[model samples]
Target chain A: MSARLACFLPLLASLAVAGERLHCVVIEVPSASLPLLREEMKRAAAPVADHGPVLLSTDGLPRRVTHRGQAPFVPEKPIPLGNGPREGSPAGARSFNIVAASGAGGGLVYDVSIQQSPVPASYYDFRTKGLVAAVPANRWQELAAWNQGTRSVSLWHHLQTDEPRAAAGDELRIELIFASMPDDALAHVPEYPPELTRQVVGHLSGTGRVWKSFSLACRADVPFHLQSSHGDRRRRQEPGYGDRVLAKFQGRITRDTPGHATLDGLLEAPRHHEGDAEAYPVSSEASIGEWRLIVLRDGPTFKAAAAAFHEIYTRRAHVAAKVNVVAIRVSVADEGEP
Target chain B: MRCPFLSRTSRWIGSALALTLAAAPARDRLHFVTISRGYDDLLREEMKRMAGTPVLPRSGKLLTGITGFPRNAGYQGTIRLDRDFPLEWSVQRSGTPGRTAGDFGFTLGVMRAGDGPGLRFDVDALESGTEHDFYRMTAESVPLPLGRNTWHPVAAWGSEYNQGMSLWCYREATAVAASTATGIHLLDVQVGFLPEPVVAAMNTFTPEHTRLARGAMAPWQTLSVSCQVDRPFSISSAAGERAMRGRSDDRGLCRLTGTLTQNYETSFNLKCQWQPPGGKKQPQVRFDVPLQPGRWHLQPVEGGPRLRATGPKGEVRVANVAAFRITAAEP
Candidate 1:
């Protein structure tokens, strides 16, 4: 049979079940160590990737440009300072603001943020080549439509400064990106829901010398169906490399896990005619529906992300010392085959 | 300040009249309300113009009530909407900071009617737009009260809220469904509610973020210019944002006034921050000003942004006012 399916009507009529659901989780991190923690995030974040992190800021940069009753102005150039610092956007806006100001003496003469202009061909090329690009100037995403289907967690102070007693003024500042786990603890996962799409469900516990902890019980399914046909007019777009409907992976782990772990992986690409969803049942006529994930250390970046999981682990890499990378680190769970 | 609702004689008369009208209709005597934080007292006086019953501007703040619904009643845990955000929240990723705005404004809360009031859910702390907010919890949810039967229970209310309450995903304070529950499966169980003021307020401050020109009432002069100075040239290691001061001799006057356009809240006051505007460390000064029209402008002082009064040593005698619009205008 198919996995748990969720059907949403365009409007609020012709629906019989109260299948509505929501989920929330809190991230607990030590507070005092947030300063040092920020450095790790900076180092760990994708380096000048295809896109820059939103609401992301660097520590120690002075926001010099400003006018009374105006936004703090920043220069278009990348600013670097000693300590790494930044404030993530509120869970909804999804981005932080970097105000760039110039001409302080004669008043603000140029503000590209308030108006729109054409970008050069060079700008377009940068984006296509996997470099960070800005949204069209002087505009913001619609506060309502930008994120039509996701939930987030509040960035709460998990508590770094809490002390065991007078003898232990030891400060352990950590940053937590508290957010809801993937929606529908058990979704009728689409053969083609979004990807980098993975999920983890399990107990949350503390681990590591720094007390870093996480779980690998979470599970997420990347779109094997390649459902996007917006570019094609032929037969609702061709199916992807997989002729499957859904792939579910179930596993378990604890706080910051380091390397590899065991997982009962299931790959099901059910073969059925068009409208066979309701009556269609998963058959033993299954193909190679299982595989083993041997996760080495963090792959050349997230390459090893597939087997990339551990329980309550920590590391002291040559580049990143005293860094505590947790087990719940999210990676786009993938399926490989020759 | 003399709001019609504040009148001793009007309260009794208005309440009595509202009661009489309430006898016949559901929402009858809910008179008119005009909220203006725009112009000088000119906009403030609109509340006084009410013939009788009137909803005053900010008679009170939002009365908060808390409730959290568990995905499953038998389940050990509960899912409660955040308080800060009327609806749910999400952390999103953007190409650049503040360039792309996200859609966090959606149905923050929902409830369906039963015999009387419906089962409700309140969404409070929404995820601010961040990586977690955007790719994370973006979808919102509300629970329905089954009352055991799980069926035939009429859904009397369902809708969205955020400003104009009708705009920005229905920013209304509350919603009520139509289609009398004559049956037929809660008939017209609908989603309807406008964004109220508080919802509107939530939309105002976004980490993702604007601009100004002169007002229509008083167009920005190509002749006049402005720039701010923090710490007014202090050689100290630290210089704060401080508007340098300016002044004119006996007969001359320095004015800092501006008009506020519609759709924009009128400012409360224009403040100066710098204790000094000269000396060192490039002056570290930043400040916010609450400006209003009709009359504005700080009294002129030496060594300020507006030191030169559009003339030779404070010589210009131009009759002008400082004004701004919700939108940025051309220079």
Candidate 2:
């Protein structure tokens, strides 16, 4: 496809949605701040950890997967966005939160108290905890600013939920805040979001897949020396890994055949693997091999809704290595009728 | 029982078709693939370990004609017989966020072992990671392939730990008749601070302070560098006047052209004007980078300075300065 045409395909797809719309927000977090963000998220998940649904973090990915052969693992540049939710799940009735797909953990999270699917209305009432209550849907754009230092609930990105009201007769409402730009301007939004008023670029549907991606890269050089029979070759070097995953996140919302909306995403993280010490016995090469840990939701975005919390601690150890992690969060928000 | 004349004619026609098919040119898309590393801690330890023991080289057999430390640097060229040479090539650690010893480049080309003719490449391994004057280097077309390339820039006077390099590749397929086998190009001009502790007082407000202190004497770090290119284009105010000329090659690749040169004294004052491809004169963007020895601090302009231009076939951006070394080539 022509580059210009490909750039507008998302905008065109978003404009085509008639009944329900998907709202998403993407935030670029300095990779250095990810650990603190994860810790803060864990604290938020504590209150609802056992009783209710909690957001999924990178703690759920496999610790390691060795490549058996020498062939390079050229991972596909992930499709910006997915398939619908699984059958049996009522469409628009659930939302899933999966963070740091490659096991490097993090997600754009507001509060851990809110359940993944069918968020309890009481969870939005932060006033009970002596914090500011969730802003009414109209002022949601005010919550869009990224605050790396905030300790409490803040809007990570605006997402709408279509899950039915709780049995307690309370409704969940999140509005789609349109970005202030014509369709032609959508392509440049991500690169220059600060120049504009909103980061919520366009809207998708429970069945219509749309995503926003961001890259967070960090690097520092290290010195190493290789001992050879003739002489020792000493040189300071940087890890020669390319732009694979400083970190990659794709937030997606998919609907089941039933039209239920779910908020979920994939996070690709750099898994720091010590190089093969036996082969290069005299070199620090063993410490430089980096693999990717993908925290992915295989079948449906909502399956791990309630199970995401307890698993966070188990996966924490896997992410201890300081590697690249790119988080793309494709979230959902209700448009409030037509 | 066929007639001899008819049979002969059919045979001749068949031979002609075979020859035509064999001679048809293949246009393999071209892009840049760079290999580099940083001087980070893990590498440092690796070096120390190497000094302690005898480590056998881990790379595969090196090609006979190729030169440089390809094997030691972990450059494994075409491993298996690739029937369809995919255009998207992999780049190694080219744009690490920080320090490195240095890096170089070689053009790796391949053909379907016995099916096609041999490949030709012009390799420059000697000047691979050589550094040049910053402004002089930016004025040249550092040919890199389209897609993801690395940008590793260090302070001029910084330790060898912070050096970076830019490189390009050129490949020629003797059997392929199409020029699309040439390459694509993008012009990325970045000017930004070298981060703190490395330098002092070159902050966001430094530009304003320069105007106040010297009245009109703009420091290299605070000067609004102008850039312009020879093409049909649209530019923002922030693009300093640097000339970039691009045109479509036979293979439809937007090949960038032109190099800026000057006497020693004139080199310090960077400026350029352009009459775009269509004979219309757009605003001129000038880049006045200081030539004082040592490190040069660069800062981003307010309101996101960008110079977006449309070449005959592609668009190029001479945008805000970032820490990167771009080596453009056709491979």
Candidate 3:
């Protein structure tokens, strides 16, 4: 047997077969609050059940005011449910029925399922409307639990965020609130050691193709590296959208310094059209944008962090572009942990 | 009571059967791989250089093999293609030109059990979260090998767009040591590319469709052709003629890149309009122009007005020009 196969044999043995019952735990937090919750759990080394205050409203707009008395924006429709631009996570449109609702610590809690009828389940969210976050039958396979019996053991929770259509931002943030099955469950849930995981959180925003940066505390024992979730953003749509120029962000944190870290941004704006196709990519002009972040640790607490942003814009395609960064949270875990 | 000779004969037969089983061709390893231009490397370097001065940073997250099985340098995996049934190739598509981040970055190459021109059902590359890599590629089922066992490139869909960082999939076979009966094939499959390098190296010019002062001329109008520095050594001009040029810097990076746009069915000429450095005349190179993945139709333009093509997963694409017939340029 290959070494990889041999190493995974034990993991395979721990998996629960189809007939077995699993204890499933689900947790939902604001898309932005996930990092904080992760940090909380990392320090405690136990599953966290309840996290307070949804940062964004049910409509996915930020609840906090940019200015006082800024009226809330009620979206006419929820984000489309078909395949997102990002890969993975089940595709095809799915609808859920809210079978049950109750008052919970976070706000109103509802039990929702893909089934047309009610099933025995409970999930937490801030509002009664807008299906917040859900794991479809297809995703249950990843959690290693059988979808049929999971309804009883699973808890559904909604994630709040502020992402408008046709804008450049982090759109779909799906967090598994928590999944805990008994030792004898039908599926084997993977676990990571406490020391290797760290949650990096911050905010990034800028205007007119210029990227900005924000710094956050870094408490990782290892050099901070890029995670797949760090680059996840909603697909933007606009004229010249097919142009290659766009915005991107990068994170830099190292264990050498200990307490400090930062997240930086790179932005690009389309200058002019170079070629044409009826339904294919057209060439355009744009400059490169690059940024970096680093953190320094002092004593027991992470006290210092710094970020830097640099952009190369051309005079030709000098158009204004806005980058609205939501609360950016990055979860860094051991590569072998999953 | 069995005789001693009968028992000895049975033992001998069992040992021979075990040896035959161990030496079977099924035990040979099947290697699957992919090779594409390192577009992401070019983009990252260009971005850093464009932002400021060049500073080489430690490379981030080298692909640990083909996504799921094991972390290795290149995207590769080993399994018995016959027994393993469906072998998957999970490629990480880190955004490139024509492909965006978050787009489904997958390439589906379907070939018959033997070999020939196959079908490229689908190809998509976009930026995505790491988790998506696990399910990015959809492994199409291949029939058991028939009689012939050899390594060759299967002409799948979009096999032409190999310039820069486009997908160019091929396979090779090697015989097991001293065993003519046993053979192992390494399938090197290059999937997608990064966006930055394509932008830096390639540029398409304006107006794919235009007319002369006289009136509307041809059914298919030749828009413009683009040339770049690093890739696509040649370009196809009007009427399927080819124009190839060569120029290089001190680093020997001389690659003539070109682009030709078509609206309907048009004819044009291929000409070496410009000379190389030192103004030396170069011989015209004849080659198949690799086409980028676009809305290319399988049917002929003259057949009907409506041409529809569906991907492996049923994604729709509409295009004209079934195949290119390159001819010598008329003087």
All candidates' TM-scores? 0.16, 0.21, 0.18
Candidate 2 TM-score to native: 0.21
Q: What CAPRI-style quality would you assign to candidate 2?
A: incorrect
Residue lDDT tens for model 2, A143-185: 2211111112222322223333222111122121111112222
Better of 2 and 3 by lDDT: 2
What is the lDDT of every predicted structure here? 0.20, 0.23, 0.23
lDDT of 2 at B11: 97
lDDT of 1 by residue, A1-338 (tens): 12322233432233212321111112112322222222322222211223343222221111111111122123443322111222222211211122222222211111111100112110000000011111212211110000001111111111112222121111111111111211221122122122111211111111111212211112212111111001111222334521122212122222122232222222122323453222111111111112111111121111010110121133322121111122223321111011
Q: Is candidate 1 or candidate 3 better by lDDT?
A: 3
- Error (Å) of candidate 3 at residue A186 is 9.2
Residue range B1-331, candidate 2, lDDT tens digits = 8799999999999999999978876433222222232221112222222221222244431111011112233332322223554222332333223433233223333333234332322222212222321111111112222221112111111112123223222222233433321222222333322212212333432332322222111112111111112221111111111122122111111111232332352222223222121122233233433322112324333222223332234543232332211122222
Model 3 per-residue lDDT at A212: 22
What does the lDDT read for residue B330 in candidate 3? Answer: 10
**lDDT tens digits, residue span B1-331, model 3:** 9899999999999999999978866434333333332222222222222222111122322221111111112233333434432344445445534444433344433333234211122222222233221111112232212112232211111121121222222222234223121111111111111112211212221111100100111112111111111212221111110111122111211112232332223322222221111122332222223322221111122211122224335643232222222211110
Off by over 4 Å in 1: A1-338, B1-256, B261-331
| Chain A accuracy as TM-score for every candidate | 0.17, 0.18, 0.20
Docking class of 3: incorrect
Task: Evaluate residue B3 in candidate 3 and report its C-alpha lDDT on the 0 to 100 scale.
Answer: 100
Per prediction, fnat is: 0.00, 0.00, 0.00
In model 2, where do residues sit more than 4 Å from their true spots?
A1-338, B1-17, B22-186, B190-285, B288-325
